[model samples]
Target chain A: MHTEAGPKRPTTPVQKGLQAIPLIINVISANFQLNQFSSLTLLEFALDSSVLLLVGGNRGRCVWATPMNNIIAYLFKSSLGKKYIMAVTGCCLFLFVIGHMVGNLQVFLGPEAINRYGHFLQSNPELIWPARIGLLVFVGLHFWSAMQITLENRAARPVAYANSKPVAASYASRTMVMGGLIVVSFIIYHLLHFTFQCKAINLTGQDFVGFTDPNNHHDIFKMIVVGFNQPLVAGFYLLSMGLLCLHLSHGLSSMFQSLGWKNDAYRPIIDCGAKVVATVIFIGYSSIPVAILVFKFGKEALK
Target chain B: MNLTLKVWRQKNGQTEGHFETYPARDIIEDMSFLEMLDVVNEGLISSGKDPIAFDSDCREGICGMCSLVINGIPHGGHAGTATCQLHMRRFKDGETITIEPWRAKAFPIIKDVATNRSAFDRIIQAGGFVSVNTGGTPDGNALPISKEVSDRAMDAAACIGCGACVAACKNASAMLFVAAKVSHLNLLPQGEPEKHRRALAMVTQMDKEGFGSCTVTGSCEAVCPKEIKLTFIAKLNRDFGVAALLGK
Candidate 1:
């Protein structure tokens, strides 16, 4: 402790206690962490110690969380594996969205388009299940990589500041996670409503009077017609579609960028490509419910 | 110009927040964005109200202290300009601006517009640097850094550590930010010694940080204040691939 002041820097009880702990304990715990580490963690601890030793009290808080500062000074030696995993997983999700939109486009080809497509998929459930599993793995990897990125961003800023101004970020991009969560909920419910025939969204004839013919085998397309006809259900579907569109809007081009699809002038073209893709996917999936209303439950049917 | 500012007000690190409206009148449009805030703060102090809290130091935009999500855009929607460097001319007369903090699960709001960006430090700590330090700050001219390498390195180095990349990304992805950090250093001959090691460490740390995955939209670069190139991101991928497949 420094003692050359009007008010002497006294060793308080807390400081005294902290100082009494053996440096060996710190080293032992750090070593235990190192053993489980994927790479040498000594850099972070060592950097923290050196910064502490060099700058001491004043600059201490500013850099305490920046473990990146002491990283071995080159990135090629440090972070390549995670980058590849991120790019690969990102590409997978991007491709899946495109495939999903294509499958969804069947609805626009008319009921036979969707029903035949659904039937075809159902007949080949064994082949499709692996696709579903792939989707799960891709989504899982995407989430894992996302979580990793956020954590690194946090550690980059340690000292809490007093005043700040806003920066440039889009509503869709900023809320990608939130939109994703909403989309996830919608996906679960959508599967239940269409695939499993959960009968959750008032799919029966009671909700919309004329659709019932007890003798008819419950048709999936018919179920969809009933679902979207209800204002509340239809509204949810529309909203979900909007969210999905937003997700695709940012998600598509980002995948290209992460996968390294860029040219100075053509970059904007790729961006436009993503926008078009999102738009097509949005219009295609959304047309299903609207089609049901147009073809099945017309203005006369409601009366 | 007179403006109605809807500022998100949070008391501390642990609190739910809401938008509080305030009037900012007779503001000079040519002032740096933070200067406008100072005028409002001065008004608040004169009226005996607690001044609005924010973060800034080098108003020149080098330190990356000012992180503001203005009207849903980080750094007020300007490309390659930090909040400190942003001028108020971007706004028009009688504009109703909604100013808030960076909204990400990873970046937690502390007070007013400030949020915890510590996740960035952690990701960088996780493995954002090289492993070749023998205690020599080599002379700038010592290493024969090629023009292409220097150019690419400069592009990556342009990342000011602003969280705009994260805020700008839809999934709250730090890939662009992390990739830039990794690629900037990894592209040069100076970075060659620790290349593989750097890729592995940074990537692992990124996973540990709870950020969402990169779906690969250029939104991070699109909204980037520095306009950091996507090439760095590609370079990051290339390096990561090498580390995963070819790195010893």
Candidate 2:
């Protein structure tokens, strides 16, 4: 019976220790070579693979059990677990969007004020790089779990209703996926236009990356003024902002509900509160494009 | 009143179902929706044809046995009403009505417009209970539940398990039903001991049964015969989160 067990799995504790030596070396080497391979990710991968090995250990083929493994299973495999992932990641992205809007609004503070803010952010690789990576991870998790849940939802009801009509669901709630997709497209374009400083897409026929201010800092204010001067770029920016706000209108309160922070007594407040915040964000972000393209706030500084 | 019904017809669970139209002539305005179907079935039986199979029990609306997705809305789109309670007068004379079963992967069609809802029973068995030994009746004020808590619990307990919430959801999610059941048991003093375990077990069972996840669309609450609040789902979420955190 002992010999019949598969050799792939390390059966005894001594065998497991022997197997772990190679894994430890792999983890260290991976950490040194792959800059993106964070220690936490490697540990998680190790835990996941160990679970697979234990379950496939050629005994009963039973699922490996542990508190941590249970937590992992609950988070990834269960419906509620997936929803929790969406909720947590959504909250992160929501905060990032607000911070981004606030950062963009620094443009209205004039050249020195906005340029200082931009330079400060750019100067801190330690602060900015981690943030960028974290944001990317959150976005990936949010979008992936969303697609998974949406596909499961679609499959749940294989037959289509002939004449279905909305009863209590709001328009924003119903169109989240569409709005999310549009906002994602907008993120790609926005990053290309501003962060990457790709002049070809900016439509202004001008290089933005090397332009320097009087203080020898990156002329972010000038870049913004020039970038938004193009009608098509500004229009797309404004459209994406609109879609982002629409996504937030339902998403903000729904986050609370999914996390179990909401109840009937505060239901009305949460609902209206979400809408009010969404509207405020919309106005705040939209002000940038409208000011640039219509009011021409920073055009004088550009010259 | 004369009405045209495009009803789903299937011989059994394995067969393909289709919409078979039948003229429901001279239906009394006072007749309930199920009663109208009964009359239609009488016609089919008299004409030597197969009668439409549907579920109805205690037409008084309390039992939650009747289910029909009429005109694309569960329970005929009436607010806080079940199919057995929906009167024919709610529909216009000469209007066309479309009827279908609770189309969900979890609730398979057993026959024409009738589905297997034992998925719910399994979920309930997974947790929805308070364990106790057989004994004499306990004192009414033994635990001293607050009036507010009892009222809230009663509101959740009002769900008749009609599966309208499932039918109305675009995703065919059973979040509302599970939420209602979880909340009804979770809020009481007697249930506090097993609260976390109940949430984890019931939610696990619900997912195992192939029901979809909640999107907080509010459609489920709107079609609920008991008018179960969406807050219960939030409460379930909270309870589940707490339970999972506790690893119960």
Candidate 3:
């Protein structure tokens, strides 16, 4: 009965949990690997299994569900579905960006204070990693869902148009993937430079040497100042934040539509508000490095 | 009246479309909007360039073939007015009028402003028709539908598949068009047999066509060009809900 019950889903928490485990494994394994087997090995396994399933489908075996038939309704039918997913993720991401910007704004509190804050964050590993994991999963899901919709859009129109003008899609809409990739890259490069110990990135200090950020608070703040004091690092940070701002401009309003929250009455007002908010928040963060650059080295600013 | 027209031109779907500024100097105020476009096309042809192609027929505003988005408003910004009935008098002399076809994911640009509105036809054909026998030469008013029901049906039947609702909606939702058909038929006793099937089939087809969902934005009604109320969508939602609950 137990063995038979395993196959008999649609009931029982145990069976549901069993069914759910593979999903969790698949989701985590699909992401950027931290250690152990490389992504390529997993890719080969996934490809081989999917192909086997495809070939096996020709026989009288059952497949879980028709992928197209199940999701096509939401992806194809309603603009609200698109807006809903975009909205939920956008709002969440916005909250995170705002929080991040606030944290980074500590740079203006003077080097010692900023360094102490960074130390506090570093010391609280138990708190930080879990938040990071949640953030990573959400970001992954948001991007995956977006990619699915964009692909569906392309499928509706197969013939390539060389001269066909795209509709009034916002800059954020068109640049979602590009901005996302840039941010992802920035995150990795940033972590390696400040958090992770890759030799190329850890030029200023030994990675993790300030261990829980700098107790005297001097070294931690000095490290951050020195990091931004470099014109090259400052430029990259500013550019990434610019992209994040552009993404938010479209993402906020678009997400509202996805979640079925927007109407003609509220859409325009919210869209404009999003644009203004995105610009302000992004510029607020970008201003830090610019401030550092100006106050510290504006006399030789361009130099 | 002198009219300067800025029209979107593209040779084909594969070609790039651009807004070309043209002058419609010495035009009569009484001519229908199509007639003004004809004058512009004539000017373009006289120069050996290709004439602009647009949809129109039954120029009296009944056929619903005239699809035009003028000055960022569908059907020249008039409520309950078809593009063909829109006259040159609506514009000032020397007005730089901009014209383009309805832009929506569901409606592809076939040529210039002419789109493949066959999508709407497919939706209707999916389940809009009633199952009736040929030999039943039924007497007039044999079904004895209530006056309110008949009037409502007539209102729904008035939809000419013009794609105006799509043009009017910000998300380009086709709910008004779909609702009109569903409501008109479902309101009558004759259509009761397939009410559930009709609603489901039409909605499925609509989604299949990539038309956006209805948020009851009321933009469709505001710029309907026919003043088709959004009650049809309400009727559709009710039908679908009942049908799904009944496990039909």
Candidate 4:
């Protein structure tokens, strides 16, 4: 299957060994030589030949050990491959969001519970930092791949349509970039307001109310109460949540489709599931601010 | 009726193109879109000017050769109808119709309104066919197929490679085209043996040709001359996943 029509000059021991395993060589070298040689020839050659030599066995047995690594590598070099990357990273971020929401829900359980939870997270610096680093990687990859694909898609159609009309795509799907930008900005604001306690909000300063729990913890419960009490801050959070909902409404289902998990039988379920999850997350997160502002449940916690 | 036409004119793939206006006089409501173009071309030739260049074959929708994005919609944006099948009655008299070629990186304009769609042929060559042996014809009922299955297969088989899906797509994705080809063959019993291989090969070729990824916009189905459904893209995705995981 090696299409090199020249003489079969096997120079290296690896080439000779590969020649002996004709069946395995044919299957591996045929498709691999055609497509993958351009980018991954050296890597695949060194890896596969070394593995074959290490296993030194009957040719028939060795033939079963053709390397599929190059095929995957080659597949990922294309636009579709980039999309698969985005889907995977997006799923990771989705999981992170769900986990964060679950943790935040402990705030409704009162000061001790939420403070203990916050203390548990902060106390494990090694685990928490590594998880944070991993999440940052996912976010970076998700954003980078998204930007790359969007630019490529835009370049594909340079000339704008004079009277364009969308038939199949939803408003949410079309506005993903806008919503994503809003969510990213909100995340920065969120980290500053709560996690870092940046000077912008000046939480510990005289201008803002500051409270610590009995254990002298950062009093995350009181901090959340004071944070949401500000109408502007609460309004920004509510608006960002709405945008996040819009982003996830399309993104969740699209992630499945991008990863090739969609089929006619389960398409409706996946689409509806995306909408439901987005709405539920929106309502769930929005409830905290609504309860703080309207019902004033956390007023005493702030004091 | 008289109609004003703003036709895009380009020398070739390399040079820039611009819109050139022309008046099509005494255009009857009965004339097909291509026939109206032909009349306008005849007038241009009689007046010692170069005629407009476009691609058309069979003058019916089946050929898939007639390609024009009229007023920003591929194949006149009429569902289930090609540019050749579009009649002049659809447009109002004295209205200016804007005609442009299929604008996608994969499809370069060879001239005015005619693009090189060989990228599509390359995708087909990648593995759009079954590996059946040549022999005497099998019995009519040799392969048992349910009516629903056959109809669905036929529905996918109706894709004419018109590139309207690409033209209409926001991303210029040919997912509908590739999906139709993959689904039509894979749905049949005769194509069962090479199902996984076909899916992998065709999708790989599609990406290699520089077509953008499908975001499931549904515009391709909306503008397809065959009205090919978007579900075929979903099937293609399914087959691609299975093939990538398990196929040789």
lDDT of 1 at B65: 76
- Reference-based lDDT, each prediction: 0.66, 0.85, 0.68, 0.82
Worst 10 residues of 4 chain B by lDDT: B239-248
lDDT, model 2, position A11: 62
**Model 3: residues with Cα > 4 Å off, grouped in runs:** A1-83, A110-120, A123-125, A154-185, A197-219, A264-269, A297-303, B1-26, B37-54, B57-63, B68-82, B89-114, B121-161, B164-204, B210-248
- Model 1 scores what on Cα lDDT? 0.66
The order of the candidates by TM-score, greatest first, is 2, 4, 3, 1
Off by over 4 Å in 1: A1-117, A136-166, A206-227, A260-266, A295-303, B1-150, B157-181, B202-227
- Cα deviation in Å at residue A293, candidate 2? 1.0
Model 2 chain A scores worst on lDDT over the 10 consecutive residues at A60-69
Indicate the residue-level lDDT of B185 in model 4. Answer: 92
Docking class of 1: incorrect
lDDT for each residue of candidate 4 in A214-293, tens digit (9 for 90 to 100)? 89886888888888888888999999999999999999998888776776788899999999999999988999999999
Q: What's the candidate order when arranged by decreasing lDDT? A: 2, 4, 3, 1
Q: lDDT tens string, model 3, A1-303?
A: 334232333355455445545544553454335232444335544543454333432323223222212232333233434434555666777898899888877766765667777767878999899988878877776776666555654544443322222233445766776797897788788877666646466444444454333355435444555567767888888889888888778777655544434443676697898889989998888887787776772232222
Off by over 4 Å in 4: A1-71, A124-134, A201-211, A293-297
Predicted model with the maximum lDDT: 2
Q: Go through the candidates in order and give the clash count of each.
A: 81, 0, 9, 0
Q: Candidate 1 on B32-98: residue-level lDDT in tens?
A: 8899999999999999987888888889988777888787777877767888888888899899888
DockQ of each: 0.13, 0.72, 0.12, 0.50
* Candidate 2 per-residue C-alpha lDDT over A73-171 given as tens digits, one digit per residue, 9 for 90 to 100: 578767888889999999999999889889989989898988999989999999999999999999999998899899988988887777688778889
TM-score of 2: 0.89
Model 2 ranges off by over 4 Å: A1-45, A48-69
